[model samples]
Target: MAALMIQGCGSDVGKSVLVAGLCRLFANQGLSVRPFKPQNMSNNAAVTVDGGEIGRAQALQAIACRTPASVDMNPVLLKPQSDVGAQLVVRGKMAGTWQARGYQERKAALLDVVLESFRALQAQSDLVIVEGAGSPAETNLRAGDIANMGFARAAQVPVVLVGDIDRGHVIAALVGAHAVLEPADRDMIAGFLINKFRGDPSLFDDGRAEIAARTGWADLGMAPWLAAARRLPAEDAVVLDRAGPGRARRVRIVAPMFPRIANFDDFDPLRAEPQVDFGFVPPGSPLPGDADLVILPGTKATLADLAFLRAQGWDIDLAAHVRRGGRVLGVCGGFQMLGRAISDPEGVEGPAGAAPGLGLLDVETVLTGDKVLRPTTGRLVSGAAFAGYEIHVGRTLGPDLQRPLLICDDGAGEGAVSADGRIAGAYVHGLFDRAEARAALLAQLGAASDGLDQHARVDAALDEIAAVLQQSFDIPRLAAIAGLEQRP
Candidate 1:
């Protein structure tokens, strides 16, 4: 099987979206195109049909290609559990936790497994478009690198270098990549693509020519900023901007931005409501004074981020906010923080094994070495049955266990909630996507509420984007580039 790989000049230069676009572009031309990434690092993850987790970006690409996601689509994933340590996922399952130096030293051993996944994808699909992580030009980290050039060499796939024109230095970045690559790696590159061009692409004719002339590489074409891109799901750890279409409300939910924040998508549905406003405050900014609600999102490191929150005077402010009749909602690690105490005697998150919590809820949490992964269906405090998923490993207990906040069918029981309703916390993510649940919460806050079918809306948006790709992109050319053109 033959393929073309998309490698970026640097991180966040739109490699994921390009892979998604190409998948749709190729699939529209009567070809079966599958997306592949040897490795990915993100807190946003999705469970596959095989009941294993992979980064959400690959899942998005799979959706764009109109294919079901599987472990073979993404063989390796790294979820940052701490500043220096990552939870390594191989073949869609947990391999183990490893620190930076240790993982880098042993990375080469995983190349065989990655290549095996690529081989499986190649066998089934007419064209496989592989995506590279970060820049291939990072000479220092090239050793045992199975992500970019190494994966290309092993898979025998030609590469297309993509540079961000909006970032400036498009020519220098492209030229610099060719300069840094070893001769063998340089030969793997088929050409380059200038991505995210804001204005008319014709204006960059001279720049494109210069890049091609300087690097001796082909220029595929410049891609304009696709407005429909927002319709696509984001697969990065960064929180989505929460400032659109939502009306101002008295019951504001202020979420503090923890450094290694995970599962921030917990708040996405709320941002769509006309009667609710959710504000995400980064570390330096003060928590809103007059807000009716404050939320603590999940963190990879519970104890370390708890310390960071207190350092920024958020601890004292949180207490004051509760006194001022503000509601606080915490999810997962945040739920652990709202309890009386959190214990990590095994040093699961860091060297320190223990930390004092905000004590807003009567619960206590103990960190465990193992992670839990399952889809959960439960009843909310308002008695509305909800469906969501849980992917954490913190055991919690509280005095008010009799009144379950979330009654899971798996006997995982319920989360903690304050009796007075001033504070609440749950382990499940995406609970608010349920219209009845969101309306119940908003009703409690005295905000006007309306039900919007989020899942249906998102599906419609994805279909619209696929149609746009069908209309605008050079589908046949992309299919030919991906080696999907069959001889008559």
Candidate 2:
């Protein structure tokens, strides 16, 4: 079995997208390729085929390879709930919450499991493409690191370092990484890749050559800015509460930003709509008065983000929006926030306590240890069939549930709708992933539906990206680096 790992100089350097594109490129060549990440830290997660949760980025990579996402793809997942602490998941199940310092001390022990997972994927596939989290430049974390160089050396996998040229100082970033890394770690990097290059590639020829000359790492080649990547769901943590470029369209849809928001990609389908004006209302910004629909996205810490919402005075804005006959919809933690109350006696999200909700829906939720991680198929009350997943920790009950906004295929009611039908909440994430659901929700808002199939669009984007990589990068070098035959 052959394996290659991709590590970046820093976070948000387009590491995830590079791995995804490579996965598709290799898969298109009739080679069985699987993506692996030893560790990933993100609140955006996806339910796997085996009733587990993995980073959404890995899930996207699985799609690029046209395979089912599995927990083994991402052995260790971290969902940040605060600045200094995160909830840990081991092989797709919650392990526990740990502070930054605490996790740093204990993470070394996880290397065995990480290698075990990687070995399993290698046994099943001809080639496994691995992705690293954060950067090995932060050598301070290198003692117990399983995410980057530590894992690469242990697994004996060659590394390709990727630097984002779009962020400027590509030369410094590449050479700086070489200067800072330990001698052994430096040797693990077999080559260097420059990503997100705009303008003329020839303009940076000397710059790339300078880095190769200084560091003596093979040049894997530069990749142009991939516009096709935008079609894929957001993977970087920076995108959690990122605001959209405000442009007025026929339908105005808005979502309040939360510090610990989870699965915000739930709104990607709506944001992609041509007739929709969508943005995330940042902490200080008030919710738009003209918004036709206000969406409350899922969160990792329900009670905490509920407090964050109120501290931003979003509750008042939501109340006013509803008073103006505007629509409101909440998913997962956001759904729990729209109800009458949220109780967390076990302190699963922090100090055990309860928080009053927006009272927009007649429902009460209590945090529980039982986390729902399953793929679901159901239809909206508006007669649209949809496929989605539920990944949250809470049990909700109330009279509003009797007027469910959705009916599951198993004959179970999901979500709640207010008496006037202007307010609704659901525990499901990615409900709008399907074109049918998007059309139904758009029609309900009195907006035109383009009826674009999201699945097909993403698939096409994958193909486009694979074709781009095939032409832009030195695929022959990449193939030989993996000890595989060059492309025929």
Flag regions of model 2 displaced more than 4 Å.
Answer: 240-242
For 366-467, candidate 1 gives per-residue lDDT tens digits of: 988777776678777567767777777678887855556777766556777788867888888777767877777777788865687555545555566566
- lDDT of all predictions: 0.80, 0.91
Residue pairs in candidate 1 whose N, alpha carbon or C atoms collide under 3 angstroms: none
lDDT of 2 by residue, 1-488 (tens): 88889999999998999899999999998999999999999999999999999999999999998899999999999999888999999999999999999999999999999999999999989889999998889998899899999999999999999999988988999999999999999999889999999999999999989999999999988889999988888876476454557787889998888888888888877778988888888889899899999999999999889998888889999999999999999999889998999999999987799988999999999999889999988999888998999999999999999999889999898999999999999999888888888888998887877788778878888899888888888888888787777557
TM-score quality measure for candidate 1: 0.91
Q: Total backbone clashes of model 1?
A: 0
Clashes of each: 0, 0
TM per prediction:
0.91, 0.99
